[model samples]
Each structure stands twice: as C-alpha cells, then as structure tokens.
Target: MPGPPKSDATHKPPFETEELRQKLAEFLDMEVEVPGSKAKKKVGNFQFGIYAFFDYDKEPIYVGQTNEQIRTRIRRHLTNQRTDAVAMNVLDPFEVYQIEVWPLPELEGKDSKDAAAKKILNALEYQIFVKLREESSFKAVLNEKEPGKPDFEVEIPHSYKGIVVSDEVFAIRNHPDVRIARRASTLSRLAQIISERQVQRGLRNTLLTQATRLRALTERRLRGLEEKAKKQGAEPEE
Candidate 1:
C-alpha cells in the first residue's frame, strides 16, 4: 500500500549542529568564538563535531575536542594558565597564546545511547580537518581523551645547593685557583694516602678489640685457678 516509502524530491542534506561543534572544540582546547545567541539557538536536524588548537605563537601547547561552546573551554585555558601561577610552567608563562578550530559534519538525532558514537565522531573529526587544512590536524575525542602529556622537570642537582653562575662568568675567577690546586695535588699520591689511612685505622681497631678480649679471658682464667688453689688448701690433707 505504501508507494516506495514516499521519496521526497526536495530533500536536502542537514548541516552540523553548534552544540557538537562547541563540545569538540572544548575538548581539543580550540578557541572558536561562536556567539552565545548562536550557540543557544536550537536546530532539530543537525549536530556538529570539532577539534581545536591552543597554540603559543607558532607552537601548539594543547589540543582538544568540542561539540558546542568551544569558546568556553578555549578561554578557560587561556585565562587560567595566564592568571594562575601554578599552571604557568605547564603553559609557559612568558609565551603568547593563540587558538584555532576545525569544524566537522554534524551527527543527527540523540547520540546518548549510540554504541559506535565515539568512533563515528573520531572518523568525522579526522575527515573534516583533513579536508579543511593543508597541514595535518589533530582531533581529540572526549570519551577517548588524549593521553596525559608529560612535563619533565629538568634540574641540575647541584644548582639547588648553590647559585649557578654562568660557566663563563666564573671561569676567570677559578683559573688561578685551578692551576695552583692541580700543581699542588697528585691524584696517584692522594690515593696512596687514603689507602694508608684506611689500613692504619683498620689495624688499630682490630688490635684494640683483640687485646680487650684477651685481657678479659686471661683475668677469668686466673680467677678460676685461684679459686681451685683456695679450695685445695681448705680441703683435708688427703
């Protein structure tokens, strides 16, 4: 009774939604400044995915994902890192920052229960960015968020104990001292002196301990012999 599912000749492809775009941008740490009114405005037929870069000068400091409201997340990174003293090292306080975003095709309908939603979104994000950019673009998914980026704390162990004057700064000051010290010191002879001291200390300790034990044993044996002689003298003449 249904005539081929009533195909519509006027049907058109739907556009991506701002919510999805904003969410993707937020996660990617992208700074796409979509207006609040625009983001608030609702569309029934569309949803979008986006990836973005939080760049410091030409270098990207962080990447993230968003579906809608990319501005919020991007601004958060910018403001928080600059204003907060603690995050300064991670964000590099002295560097200037910038942000850019990649928009992807909108996903349709309720995606809450969609089993393959993340995979689908990743594929879409990757495809859209690749199409839009000449250079490679990264798309970070929310569910599959990027791995924790490591921040190695480089330190000269000796620096904590003393000020690190430049090697060149102190070079002239140490030149005369170094020459005098090296002329006065002999490495092989110093080793011989150390060996001699160690051997002397060891021998002294060994002799002292042995002498103390011997004195105690000798005194004990003499007391025992004296006791035996006293007992013999006290006994009957048998």
Candidate 2:
C-alpha cells in the first residue's frame, strides 16, 4: 500500500525570501516599553512615528514618517511595490537589512487628520531626518521628498532598532561585492528613468545619492580585495 496521502495543504519551502518576510514580521511584532508609560506596545502598531532603514553596512539609507500605522506603511514600502519610492526605483527593498522605528505612543487614538498631531509628526520626521543625515557617511538618504519644516519641534522619542533579515540571508547579501553590484544596477536604472522623462529635482537628488552610495561601496570592495592580495603575497609557501 502507498504511504498516507500527502496533506492537501501545499508544503511551502522556506526560501530566503520567505525567511526574510518571517524575520521582518517577527521584528515588527516585538513589544517595547512605551515612553512615559508603563505599557508595552508592538513597535509596528504605532499610528504615528518615524522610521529609518539601514543597509547591510548599517548605513542609513532611507527615512520616512507615517501618520497611518507603522506596520502598514513599512509593509507597503518593503513587502510590496505600492509605495512611490519603490515604484520609482528610488529605494530597493533588497538593501534594507535593518529597521529603526520611533513609536509615538502618546499619539495613540488621536485623529489622523488632526492638525496639531500632523505638525508634531512632521517635526519628529524632520528631526530624525536631520539626525540620520548627520550620522550618515554620505550625508544623504534616498528620500525623494524632504521632510516638511514645521514651525515647532518635538522631542525625539525612544527608538526600537533591530535587523529584520535572518543570519543566513545576511551572510549572502552582506558581501561588499554583492552590494556594489546591486547599487550600481539600481543607479543605472534610476539614471535611465531620469533620462527618459521630465522629472523633479528630488529625483535628480536621489540619482546623485545613489551614485555616491555606489562609489563608496565600490571603493570599499576594491580596498578589501587589494588588502587580501597583499596579505596572500606576504605569506610563505611551503
């Protein structure tokens, strides 16, 4: 007799892409202490906050704010191609290895369209944007639009940061050569898009930022290979 019939449900193999999605889901579900409160909330449930994306090198690559749910906005940007940034090729989700989110628990239950709340959100986004820019090696991010300048400022909130990619995935994507090639390809595509259509200055700015990133990664890869060659030449052969 044949063995028990296979289950009706399809057995989905754990591909690296699926592994990444699972890891990202876990990261977003993580609970953290809410600022100025004893309550803990999932980082992704916050309705108003700023979030930043970091590359394999831990370099800040993109920053965004969401008046909607953080989970929804981030998923659209990463898991799908709905976001303008993703559609325009301004940001490649493959490059996002880590995520940092600032959840404004205080803004919970507030109306999404409330003017005061929007101002605070804008201020917070601008603050994080400036801070990230200052900390970045290239002094730039891939945002096509600059954060609005609100008349007032808000204190930056406590942030929850974590890598969303699994170790197995990281090992493959973290190589400098791999990153350089990916960056170069993205740059080429973005340049082509700009060349083919009438575009805004922001798109041009993104192109420039991509170029800078590609150059930096290429230089780093070249240095690593040269160092390896020199070390090998210095070793005595048995």
Candidate 3:
C-alpha cells in the first residue's frame, strides 16, 4: 500500500513560544520508548512533574502529574493501565505520538515537599487543560477529568506560532497497529457497558434514567466535535 503523503515543504506548527519550546525540548531529551520486545516502564527519575500527550498534529490532548517519577506515571497511561482514559472513551493511544514533561523541583525531606508539588502540578495541569479546551483549531481533547483548581502558580506554554517538531506523527491511519489499538479501545468500552448493565439488574429503572441523561450529554459533545471538524476543513486534526 502507498505510504502517507510525501511533502517537500517543512512542517509548521500552529503555535510557538520560544521559552516554552526550549523547555519542552529539554524535558523530552531522554528516551521513553513505549512498545518493544522487552517491557520497560518509567523513563527518567523525574520526581515531581507535569506531562502532556500530544497527537499527530502536536496538539495537546491530556495533561497529568506524578508524585514519584514522571516516566512511571506515563507508562501506566501508555501501556498496562489506561482505565481512566478508556472508560471515558476519550484517548485513543494510537493517536499519541509524543509526550513532553516539565520536571518540577523535588524538595526532599522538606515538610512542604508533597503539598507544594501537588499544588503546582494541579495548577499546571489545569492551565494547560484550559488552553487546549479553548483552542480555535483542534477538535475534542481527551481531558474528560475535572479541571484541577489553580492553587499555585506554575508557568505553562501559551503560544504556538512557528516550527514545532517532536516525535514523528505517523499518518498511517490504516496501519495494523492503529486499527488494533482502536479496536481494543472500542472493546474496552463495550466491556464496561456490559459490566455496568449486569450489575445494575436490580436498579434497572434508575440506570435507564441516568443513561438517558448521559446519552444526551454524549450527543451534545458529538455535535460539538462535528462542528469543530467542519471548522477545521479538510483533514481536520483531532
């Protein structure tokens, strides 16, 4: 089969901020290979950090944090345990091509270490979440979790206006890997729905009532995604 389009022109990012870009580059300096013959979890010994998952177009989809090591936390989402993302039908692992992390200063043996880091991480995640939710170009992001309340101030990237590049975003939508990942995600959701139904046998009426409301919300979100896609025109980025 033919491969993805070959272009001569250089790829340009929709947004760019010099300082933020530099920071991202530095954070992802080391390798965090996802799938290999041997299983590997955790990348660097980053104690406390905030990380983001970007799709094929370099658009941020999810933002999260860690208490001990950034790589270990991310490994959970990418590899074995993606329960949160899959349950919500938000993130499709195949779409994620790269991850960027911002390591926070780990204050060991300090009374305020855990508290301080938690506050900063929450604020940073929320800041990035709002930015992505408000972006004019992208469609739905996978951050279905509640936005963390801003407690402490931590700088987050806010501009995108130049050449931004990272892990290559594979354009091979029809690739076997992509199809398998997507199928697995679909099955996950199906399993959840089935399990919930089985357990709600005694509370069928209440389940139906809640399902109705949830369906309404899902429909609304679907329409929103459709509108966003239209606005993005041909070959819209998700």
Compute each candidate's TM-score over C-alphas.
0.27, 0.91, 0.50
Give stretches of model 2 more than 4 Å off: 1-14, 234-238
Candidate 2 Cα RMSD (Å): 4.0
lDDT of 3 by residue, 24-122 (tens): 444434444333225332334545666777754465656677776665676566544565664444455555655766655433233435676567767
Q: Which residue window of length 10 is worst by lDDT in model 3? A: 158-167
How high a TM-score does candidate 3 get?
Answer: 0.50
lDDT tens per residue, model 1, 1-238: 7555534543532222232234433434422333332342221112433433422113232334444333444445444443221132223212222344443323335353454644555554444333333332322111112323323221111100111122343343234344233322322333344456554343343233323333444455566667877888864223
Superior candidate under TM-score, 1 versus 2:
2
Give candidate 3's whole-model lDDT: 0.52
Cand. 1 TM to true fold: 0.27
Clashes of 1: 24
Worst 10 residues of 2 by lDDT: 5-14
lDDT, candidate 1, at 165: 24
Model 1: weakest 10-residue lDDT segment is 155-164
